[model samples]
Target chain A: MNYLHKELYNLLISDHHIFDFIRESALDGLWYWDVENPENEWMDGKFWTTLGYDPEQMPHKSSAWQDIIHQDDLKVALENFKKHCEDPNHPYDQIVRYKHKNGHTIWVRCRGMAIRDHNGKAIRLLGAHNEVSALKKHEEILKRCNSAASIGYWEIDFISEKVLWSTLTKEILEVERDFTPTINETLAFFSEGKSKTSLLNAYQNAISKGESYELELPISISKEKTKWVKIVGIPQITANKCTQIYGTVQDIDLRKTNELKLREEREKLRISEESFRANFEHAAIGMAILNEKGQWLKVNNKLCEIVGYSQEELRQLTFQDITFPADLDADLVLFQELMDGKRDHYQMEKRYFHKDGHIIYIILAVSIVRNNEGKILYVVSQIIDISELKEAKNKIHSLLKTSQEQNNRLKNFAHIVSHNLRSHSSNIGFMIDLLTNENEKLTEKEEYKLLKTASNNLAQTIQHLNEVAMIQTTLEENLQAISLSNSIKSAIENVAAIADAAQVKIINEIKPDEVILGLPAYIDSIVLNLLTNGIKYRSENVDSYIKISSFHSMQYKVILFEDNGKGIDLEQYGSQLFGMYKTFHRHPEARGIGLFITKSQIEALGGRIEVESEVNKGSKFKIYLKNEKDKKPMYHR
Target chain B: MKKTKSLCIIDDDPIYTFGLKKIIEFGKFDVETIFYENGKEAYENLSQVISDGESLPDLILLDINMPIWNGWKFLDEFTKLLSEPSVVVYIISSSIDPKDREKATEYQIINSFIVKPVSIDKIREILQSN
Candidate 1:
């Protein structure tokens, strides 16, 4: 019977190997202590091993474990263990450090329970020790991640409805470390309106349904300061009921600021586009957008008005199509450079074909539009129609030409005046010199002849200058309608004796009804000069024949005077035939003034005179006079 | 100083030429006078005399305004005929233009530019100075 009882006890002990197997696999140590006697303790070999000790060398006593306990944790571990021994029902749990065999400390977690007799006297304590060094290192890693990410954890007790904040959470909120806030007080820290409401709803939903949620919300930790945070809420469930709410809170203020700045930049771009549109549409100068082919992409009202083309029509045609042919190649070359990105802008004075097919000069300034990468987008052309300015310029050129011609005439007149005046004055000086100088022994008749010649030259020069001045100042109102036949007859009658002496026969073929608009005295002078010239310059070896005739032609009364005399060399004197003091013939009676006065008088009456002659042939003078009806047709008729 | 042996007047104006000739003759300046109508005729006659190895006129009165080959052009051609620069030249002209006087001064062969009408006293002074 004694042998059987010892065997039963061994069976009971070996059956407990399952617990030993679990402790060994979990890397835990097992221990037992006698509460009835303060010195009785039992430590598994694994416990000594965890403390870096050999159990075979150590005695089994409470002092053996007490000797390895860390000094700072010994008191707290002993007090908690004493409480567990005294109550016999209290849960025993503690985290403490044990000294290693190498003199360094190792972290450990101890859990234990009290064993009592039927009378409730505590007999022993059973516990397990976990070498929590790796777990502690893992916890430190999690804490560092949270701090680096600016993330903090939060918890809410469902039963107490109170919120608990971690150290990082308190730091993020800029709150005191010891401050414990209720759920309502924590919600009050959120922004007053939509943020607070959304956060409360999410929190309540998480607590009720054991759901997890994430929200980005703006929270105001103080009266005036606000920050953006990402809130992640997870509910803790036990028996399928939510007991606690816990989540992470991340400060996202920097990201939120960047987003807001991006939105403001977008709004500024929109405003810039609006301003560009307004300027393009309402600019005073003509503006247009053209494609690479020079076709108008868009045109403003000013452009349409300038080209006299409708917007639709302008868009349908390229600029080259409407440009004047002369200006096409030059404008095209500049446009090609713009397309190649060689030039940013080009300006030129160009001509375009208007709607009416006339060339209109314009000053065009064109700029190339480019994308960010320097690709040509389109061309913006500004056209300034300078047609009127061009016209005025042309007018000025014509005026300059006329002014140059008039200046040349004035120079010629000055030369002629100088020559005539000098000849007469020099003659007078010669006469005086001859009369006073005792060295020159002049005869009386010779002296008288020289004096007479000087006087005649002086008088002729004065008379010719007076005639020029008279013609210049005479008004158009001084002209009148004079009978052509009567003027010719009177002139012929004045030179009758000279005509008879020269054996010149005058034939009057002038129509009695023919009349011309002229100054009467000027008409008399012109006819008298011509007739006398015909008789005075008569051929010395031949009979002189003078035939005069007048006829009515279109818009003029034409008078023809034909004289059979030595004709002039028209080619040699054609340009200066009527020039003042220009004499082609060397006749003694040729003062070189008759034709000059005749030409001036005819011009003053708005008529013209032309001569037809050859070197040896007779000469014909065709005088064109304004017909009476042609002068003021409506009034005269 | 010796009086000039012979003097020549080349002018188109007959009255001025005749007056000048009489003044030179009556001055008893001991000079035979020669006359020509224009510069062309005068240059031809003078060139012929020089080519024949005859002595040129001691003094020449050249007129500026003439029908053909006036005084300035004549002087340009006349200098080529004679190597000696001793013959005195006097320019007589009715032109009061300053440019003419300036032009006359540019010719080194010309002695003086005189404004016509040429007086006997001015001629007398020129002869005496020469």
Candidate 2:
């Protein structure tokens, strides 16, 4: 009993100041109990004072602790205390909650130690309770932060080459909760490709060089499972050497996949824009892009060259500034229609004034580009240079007019000669008749005979002139379809006496079914003239003959007259052979009028006559005439 | 045969006039002859005769193409001064153009159209028909 009292009395009186100092220093509340004397329980003054109460207002007895203890913690408190009192080796150390004077539950770490006698039975219990609610709250917040961020901490020991992963880190690696990993095994979780290589390098740099690194990479944790993680590693150096590497491994798979998708989309957009720019620049035709205000937004090199302006110079001007005044209104109407969305595209031939103030004809095809919501964005214009084509068209028009004027002059010549010839022939005939009546007064009748011969020659000249006039004015008469074979037969019969006198053989091979559209009289005149001319030029050495045949070609019916005649030298006199007053042969009867009239008649009837002759060889006169059965009449005259 | 008081011929060709004069004299038609080288000379002389109220020619021959103020233009001025009821005008030209013939026929006072180089027989027939 004295030993027990000495422990208490000495602790309270001799070292009572030390006991008070320990109670004040170590805990917010303190208590002691004498188990043999249950009535001798004492609660420290701080026990009540820590709860914002004066010791006088609260009982100093240990029985008062039951009321102050939380109701929920009372049963636990009594059981733990009794167990500690019954056993000397057992310690009472636990966390419990207590009710504050303000009716709030306070979390405290409570520790109790028991003192026992020689019998090895606990006699007194002494305990300390310290409030730890704020610390525990901070620990809870840290756990929440880890879960939200998907962050897990890991550490690698250099000595043992072993790895320690937090509970969240194990979850990230898709491993079991009880699993322990080696440094090599943890590195195996990274993919075997580029990510693995990079991860290995980063791990080596962190451990060997005291370097810190952060990387996001793809990692394969299990079979058929891949994830992306952001790793941040920092080195811990000891004694100027790296001894540990530790970092966080965050699951960033969703964010990284989305970032990759965004980058790929941006790359595609860049490629398409490059392609559009390239096509516009290298196009063979001029191309331009203009904004809604007709301002040049983009112009290709071809357009700049056509307008004779540099890109910088052209950027300051609108489309209207370069357009020729005459074509502006028409082009504007189309442009306005496009702006109003009434028309999507328009094409027109418009002119532009080059920088040098010269005209350039262009065919413009323009279209409006619109946004997805149908708002006008820009105008895409294409230009084709047609200045050369326009020049060619103008040249052709002038040539046609000149040719028409020549035709009119020929008609005029025909008209004037018709009247002049008739007048001359009539005068000669009248003079001849008057001279014949005065024959009695003349001494030489031969003089009168010479005058008569002059009149007869004048009549012959008039007849030839009439024949030319008929060819020229054939268009004024009705053109009728005639049978070529019948015409040839008639011409042959008409010249039968002459052919027979010359002993000429006529071989006619023209088909009876073949037909042509021509004036009847002109056809007879043409055939008769050819036959007579052939007879007139018949070869003296060989048996004279004329072979006539007709056949159809693609666009014309060709009539061939092959003759065994004394063919003239066409190389020397070829051009003049069909010319009026151009006689080739020395025969007195050879009048050049025949071929000239024949050519004119053939041309007027929409046919062409070509003579192929070699000095001694036969002459083949090829006449290409229209085959009326296949198509409409080409030439009325 | 009908007798004519006066016959007038307007032509630029002297040969045609000489032949017509010989034919008329040979055929013995009773008519007076008057001559003009072109429409201008004939129009002036005839306009004086009409203004003086003198007797007009019974027949007039007009040529189409002349040196000055040809037949068509002369007709425009002469038609306004038309007062003689017995005078008949005939267009004498060598043109075979149908358009000329149609245009000459439009004048109501024109008797007929005749091609030049007049013969004796045609002169007698013209005198008899008139």
Candidate 3:
């Protein structure tokens, strides 16, 4: 009925082109109504077609629209229309759904103007309609995507003094869902100092110069909560000036914190590398880094000086190239073990050939290096040169050898002098008795007795001295690889008559193939002495059996001579057991020189003799000889 | 005491044996004497005596430091033959070294150790004690 006055709106809007504005974009249909005559209506073809109705079949009256509108939107549409008619100055606008001929509801945007005479009463209505269902669906989709991603968008209208925010922006700021923020309130969410300054400058730049800004900054979301957020602002310029600005905002708290921590770790690794390089260059001892090929990748100054090669020169050679030939094989074997993962590190006293062709005795320590992925990379070798110490040790060794020889010589001389003096004194004692005997006259028989005894004692003493001298100077003896069992057999045969006389049963259990480095004569003498001692010390009650057997340890071949005889108390005579003339038992044949000489012979051949005995049990004499197959003579410890 | 049947002197020195022999006779001990200049000769002859079925001497006087088997080696062989014969061995040597004195104590069959120049009194005492 009001649209009957629309002819008056047409005169003003036709020139002003308000209809063309709607028709160009959002207009789906046009309508005019006469307020005085509600049945008088005009509808465009598209108005019926918008609801899937043929234009001819579609109604042109207001009642027809009322009948076709969905019940949910019909009440609100009628209330809007009635209210606008009361005050024609108010514009008419409603969004409502109408029933289509196909029985589906389609959303329509209806905007109209109520034109009235100067009396301010509704006269006519003019409006444009548009189907807005698809546009609303797109906005819903966009809003859902922003909420899921915690992505927020904001816009500022320069001319309107307006600010707009997506739903996520309000959530990020911890504000109520319906809260509308002014431009000042939005800017205040950034922290008060640096953040405020940067955000303000960026916003002004975007609005005034149409420049874009992207920043990650901290913002205060609440009194106690601060969040890291990324913001991107894109300016919309109109007439060469920014009219509006909009951008996306995303919370970046976790990502930014993790990025900062990763940077710190890289910084710490850089610092460690710096210190390692400093230590390597300034080390006091020689050190070097080697590649898998053992080529010098880096050498410290000390290493260069030790090897008498410049850094450039050393880099051209491998570790094996400069090692002494005598020591290279051993050093390389240990090095190869490191590369093969069989060992983590190794150290050895090895000799290196210096640039001057002299040997440098160095203790080399090498350690393995691996990559982050656990692949073998290189090795670090530290060398400590010790040639001076080696020189001093060798000097001491030779000095000790000389002193030991001197001590043995002096001991032999003393024994010979004592023997000579004893023999001479005995002869004189006999002569004095012969010349002045109370029981008989000084006759020719007595004179001849003194003369013969004196001469014989002198001659025998000379022979014994020679034997002592020979045994003392063991250097004069010939050494060879003699079978221990064969030597004992020959010695047994030498004393066979004595053993036979004493009824000594000798059990030679020595392994026939067991050989040792020894002086054949000394072995024979040693075996002979032990056999005689066993026979001489036999207990009258027991059947004596002398058992000779062989055993060995890591370093020495041993022959054990055990006897069931009147064994001496070794604990009481241990100190003097091998002393010349120091006899422990009460036996006429224990001249004692047998054990003394045997011990001397064993020591001279780099062997040792030990005795264990109980008073009534037996005696066991163990002779240990070095098994020197490599031809390096081993001495008694 | 029992009177000794026979005595043996094993010494390389003839004069020492002669002086010992004279003292035994002078003491009126009524003992026969056998003499060998060295241990080897005494050992061989003693073994021969055993083989011949002759009785071993009651007492044997031995000397040390002899050639061809000293007193030590001789005792080593001689003691084997003495198990059946109750021979009392005495070591009489002129060398007064303590070594000889100590060594003479090793043999159980050796009854005494006497130094050189055996006295007439010592010989009488030995005979009286046995």
By TM-score, the best candidate is 2
- lDDT of each residue in A66-110, candidate 2, tens digit only: 776777676776788788778755668777877778887677888
Any idea what lDDT model 3 has? 0.80
lDDT of 3 by residue, A229-273 (tens): 999999999999888888899878888888888889889989998
Which sections of candidate 2 miss by over 4 Å?
A1-195, A216-406, A437-494, A515-526, A551-554, A601-607, A626-637, B1-130
Classified by CAPRI criteria, candidate 3 counts as: incorrect
Give the CAPRI class of candidate 1.
incorrect
Off by over 4 Å in 1: A1-110, A113-125, A128-159, A166-180, A183-226, A230-250, A386-421, A428-637, B1-5, B14-31, B119-130
Q: Can you tell me the DockQ of model 2? A: 0.23
TM-score of chain A of each: 0.49, 0.62, 0.50
In terms of lDDT, which candidate is stronger, 1 or 3?
1
DockQ of each: 0.21, 0.23, 0.13
Tell me the tens digit of each residue's lDDT in model 1 across B1-130.
5754787888888888777777776666767789988888988999999889888887888988788888888888889887878689999877655567889989998999887767778888877776
Deviation in Å, model 3, residue A206 alpha carbon: 6.9
**Clash pairs (backbone) in predicted model 2:** A12-A16
Better of 2 and 3 by DockQ: 2
> Which residue window of length 10 is worst by lDDT in model 3 chain A?
A469-478
